[model samples]
Target chain A: MTDLLPRSGGPDPASAPGPVRRPFRDLSAEGRGRAGGRWRRGRVPGSLLSRVERRERRWSAGPAPAAPASRSLLAALLLAAATVTTLDLSTDHGPVEAARGVVADVVGPLESGTAALVRPFTAIGDFFTSRSALRAQVAELQAENDALTDQLATADVDTRRLATYDALAAEADDLDRAVVAARVVGWGAAQTFTDTVTIDAGTEDGVSADDTVIAGDGLVGRVLTADSSTSTVVLITDADSTVGARVGSSGTLGFLTGRGEVSDGATLDLELVDSTEVPDRGETVLTWGSQDGAPYLSGIRIGRVTKVYSSLRDSSVRVEVEPSVDMTSLDVVGVIVPKGTDSARGLITGSSGSSDTSGSDG
Target chain B: MSPVRTLVTGAVVLAALLLQVVVAPHVAWHGVVPDLVLLVVVAVALARGPQPAMVLGFCAGLLVDLAPPAEHVAGRWAFALVVVGYLAGRLRPDVAPTALSTVATVAGCSFVGASLVALSGLLLGDPAGVGTGELMLAVLASVVWDVALTPLVLPPLLALLRRLEPGPA
Candidate 1:
């Protein structure tokens, strides 16, 4: 049993080595010895053996040093990446946008080409599905036109009041702003970075960063970054988006923040500034307008209040508002550029001219 | 590297980029598009070495950021891709990986890549960054897509790379 156990601790393995191990000593003498001859295949030159030993020692020491050029390159790449991300996030408009513009100038054409190529297939599918809808839409428009024409005959008595209202409405449209029409060319890249869209009209078309974007219905978003021939718009529903809004009838001031998309629907949270002025359900929300109305213009419809909640801990009133425009189907939109000092002159001329024409017809 | 090999690598990267930009949106499901550029970079990194891989990853990421419709903060993807490229390059193909290992590499790299993007964005105070709950879902989805696409992408890419470069073939 003891033999089967294999001489346990008979000699410390270190001291019980069969041949005397002098690891540090020169092996040349050992290599020429009678016993070492069996292990040695041939008489290797001392210089060659020493070289091999030295090479092994260097390798066992630790990791090899990286080339200075490679280290510099890595550091440079990291620095560049960090700088760009910081600039893009911090600045409203910057060189990052310019670089994107240049790339967009190249990529936009390719995208258009692809869209043109694929349109026929999409058109064919839409043709089959939309014929009835198109017919119904045209009939509805015709009926609306006929009704408006009949109303025009009885408008003389109310012409002055209607003109005042028209002037007010026009003023609400970013103070009768000079508008530039743009078409949505693409949706936000990859779904991970959501709630943005690209438009074909860009800086050259008098569109600038922070300009207000709107569809026919209501506010869409503001221009996030602009280039020469294209611009990116961060939609009102983007997670990063927030607009100062006023609630209906009462005009209670609040901030509408994007809640991103949920399974039920895409929603916005309207948190009142006063918290005491809690908006009721179904109250319309409109942009409260930032100073100069740069990003979000005043009177742009945001949404209507759906559900209101008052938090117990913070005493903050938060209301969930469903967006007015269908974010999923944004196509053609317009950028609102503020008119110059002549805005007042233009408004008066337009309103007076409309009133005179209405009075004469009556 | 030989000029021909360099040119071949460039052409491959350009093609991958074009495909990603031009064709990805049409095929995207639930806002998640399969990242072909990531797949191509990792495959190249595994076949090549870390040095060129890092540079290539940076270039590809930069292009994606600068291209139309890339509205997120610039350099976020570049930073993420560089790290992924370096990691993938570490597993030099001295011996061929089995199918299981290949799948693991794809999943692992994709997970790391997505996490890096989220983490870096969060660190930078990027408002566009996804919430924590959504981040996990996005990473998992990215991993699934990457793993599924890897087999189709990597083998052919490696063979082509070997043919392009002088020493390997």
Candidate 2:
């Protein structure tokens, strides 16, 4: 390695025939010729002597006797790991889940603290990367705001009609649930074959498993599990996730499956139950809601269709959707928790029939 | 290991875990983040040898497996990292290694570790398993990320560990 270094003002020590040494006077030889020569008058530096001694010791020691011990340790650990994996895979609600919860509880605070410290830098990075997208969003919102203002200006002439519209809007928005707000604190490890995020909220904050999570734009995912102070949310873009979806105003029903990619314009695959019904590009998709809205709330926007493909092996059509929420840069999110079983039942009674029909078809 | 060395190792592992969970995701490229803990394991192996590396690898792997937001079965990372730690430790030289050799070992271990985890997930019937093409892409991405990060992560880590332990070369 020293040979790789540029030469200074002298010959390279590495290229010398003998060991490199400092050009010091031969004081030990002078003392040897004088007196009894039993002891040298001048000696090598103590540090240098010790370094040479250490080198000799290292050479004598050779490979340490720890090789066998380490081999045995490796074998033991591998076996232990295999046991844990088998135990975890063989049982549901096993000790592994409890241990995971404990680990999460311990690590949650540190993750959130680190996230708080690091968020600003990440925001700065995001600003630069998505500046063009942000500008486009601003323009789109401005146009929408202008259209809404025009509608408001003409509303006074139809006060009765406006009242009914307001009532209908309230009804549509009413899921009889409370939203618990949280910030994303961490994400799944790179090795884990799942797309998930950790949020700084849990059962204590009324964020429970199966509750619907959403960002300002649209649906994010559902709470997979909750510890005391943190919860894991399996993203809608996870391979294992599936959401019942309704296509545009056509009401064509289907199920959306995640493609498991999120950073680079990740899209979900929407498979319509009625193979003959074709969805047009740009049609919006929304969650049709499950019973009691446990996993997803009805009317929450998912995304707009970008492309449609007809299956070569079957009559089914596959619609690709870019999620309304950017799964890559999640920040503040809301978890929708049903107020109570009674309230949830009351809210679901009217729509239960239609939902059941859609569910059956899907 | 001495108690002080053990404590320092634990601290470093914990810090790596925090960074892996909090910072890695934000820096991900194309939906893949570098495995910081895995890199730490390799660094430990290179500096301390096989025994300590295996112990650290197992413990750190368990922490990663059980960390929040992890949806797959536990211990897959543990198993994979143990093998990586062993391989990296076995590659350690009697003399200090050159920079090029160190980087190559890191890249090789990263590839092996990522592939092991993915293959184990597939063998265990993980629902999150992707198709072969996507799996290959993810593994390659992780290797690239780990190699890119070695210069930033490994040198400082090796320095710190050598300071703490000061073992025979």
- Candidate number achieving the greatest TM-score relative to the actual structure: 2
What is the per-residue lDDT of model 1 for residues A1-362, given as tens digits with 9 covering 90 to 100? 11222243444333423224533222322232211222232334577875653333221111111112255666777788888888887786689877887888877666556555665665565576468867987997899688768767765645654564465366464255556777666665433445677777776776778988988888888998777677788888887898998777666888887854522257887878888787778667878877766887778878788898888798877689988876754657878775432211121112322221111100
TM-score for the A chain of candidate 2: 0.68
Scored by lDDT, the top model is 2
Task: Tell me the lDDT of model 2 at A307.
Answer: 95
User: Which whole-number lDDT from 0 to 100 does residue B127 have in model 1?
Assistant: 56
Alpha-carbon error at B159 in model 2, in Å?
Answer: 1.4
What is the C-alpha lDDT profile of model 1 across B67-149, one tens digit per residue? 77777779988887887777666654321334455567667788888888767756765655467877677677778878888
lDDT of 2 by residue, A1-362 (tens): 13222334544333333212311112221122211122222343476654543333222212222242377889999998998898899988899989998998989878888999998888998888789888988999899799768967875645654554465345445654556778999988545558899999877776778988889999999999988888999999988899999877466889999977777689999988887888878677888778767777777888889999987687768789989999888999988765432221122222322222122110
Which pairs clash (backbone N, Cα, C closer than 3 Å) in model 2?
Answer: none
Q: What are the lDDT scores of the predictions, listed in order?
A: 0.66, 0.75
Query: Please, what are the lDDT tens digits per residue for candidate 2 over residues B7-119?
Result: 88888888988988898888887768888899999988876677878988999998889988787888988998899889888876432344556788889999999999989
